[model samples]
Target: MGSSHSTPVAPVEFDHHLVSALADNAAIPVPSPARQSTIDAHIHARIQAELQRLREDEATVRDEMHAALEKENLDRERALAHDQDSAASSATLLADLDQVRAKVDRFHARRDLSQLPALREARDGLVVCYKNNTSTPLDCWQQVETFRASVSELEKQHIQSLQ
Candidate 1:
C-alpha cells in the first residue's frame, strides 16, 4: 500500500532542482528555524525513497542472474548428452569402416584394375567441360551425366566379366 500524502522523489533529483535555481542566480530567502526543520525532514524522506528504489533494482538483477545460471546449466547438460551420443555412433562407424576397408583390400588383391578407354575419354571430356565453363559450371551437367553413364556401363561390363 502506498501513502497518498507523500509522492517520493530521489535525493539526486531533488538536488537538481536546487542546483538549477542557484545557476539561474535566483535569490533564496534564508529559512527561519521552523522552515529549516521542514527542509531537513523533506531531504531525509527523499533519501529513504532513493535507497528503497535501489534495493528493489538490486533484487531484480539478482533474480535475472540466477535464471541465466539455471539456463547455462541446462545447456551444459544437453551438450554433454549430445557428446555421449556422438561418441557411441563414432565407435560403431569406426568398426564398420574397418570391415569395409578389409573387404576392399582383399578384392583389390584378387582383381586387376585395368583402365577402360571409354571411361578415360569420358573423364577427360568432363575435365575440359569444367575448364571451359568456369563461370557457369552448370553448363557441364551434360559432361557430368555422360561420365556417370560411362561409369555405369563400365561397372556392368566388369560385373559380367567377373561372372
Candidate 2:
C-alpha cells in the first residue's frame, strides 16, 4: 500500500473506412416477396399435377383388371358350353350303341334257334306219331302251324322294338 499511481487509458474510436468496408461486404440482394410467392405456387402446382397423374394411372390399371376378369369369365363359359356339347354327343352315341346291342341280341337268338337240333327232332317225332295214330284229328296239324306263325310274329315284334 505504498503510493498507488493509476495510468489514464484512452477511449477506443471506430474507424469509418473499416465500418463502410464491412457494411459493403455484408450486403446481400434479397428476392421480392411476389417473386418468392410465385416460385412457391409453381412448386405447389407441379406437386398437384403429379398427384393427378398418379390417380389416372390407378384408374387405368383398375379398368384393365376388370376387362381381364371379364375375358376370363367368357372363356370359362365357352369351355363349359363345349363340355356340355361333347357330353350330349357322347350320350347320343351311347344310345345308338344300346340299340345296336339289342339288334345283335335278336340276331343271335334267331341264329341259336336255327341251330337247335331238338326242334328238328321234335318235328320228326310229331310226324311219325301222327302217321302212326289213327285218332289224331286233321285240325291238330293246323293248330301246330298256327303256333309256329305266332312264334315268328313274336320274333318280328322284338326286332321292330330294337329299331
User: Whose lDDT is greatest here?
Assistant: 1
Error of 1 at 152 (Å): 84
Per-candidate TM equals: 0.34, 0.35
Backbone collisions counted per model? 0, 0
Once fitted onto the true fold, the runs of candidate 2 whose alpha carbons sit more than 4 angstroms away are 1-30, 85-163
lDDT agreement with native, every candidate = 0.83, 0.76
Which candidate wins on TM-score? 2
Q: In model 2, state the lDDT of residue 99.
A: 84
Question: On residues 29-87, what C-alpha lDDT tens digit does candidate 1 reach at each position?
Answer: 67899999999999999999999999999999999999999999999877865897867
lDDT, model 1: 0.83
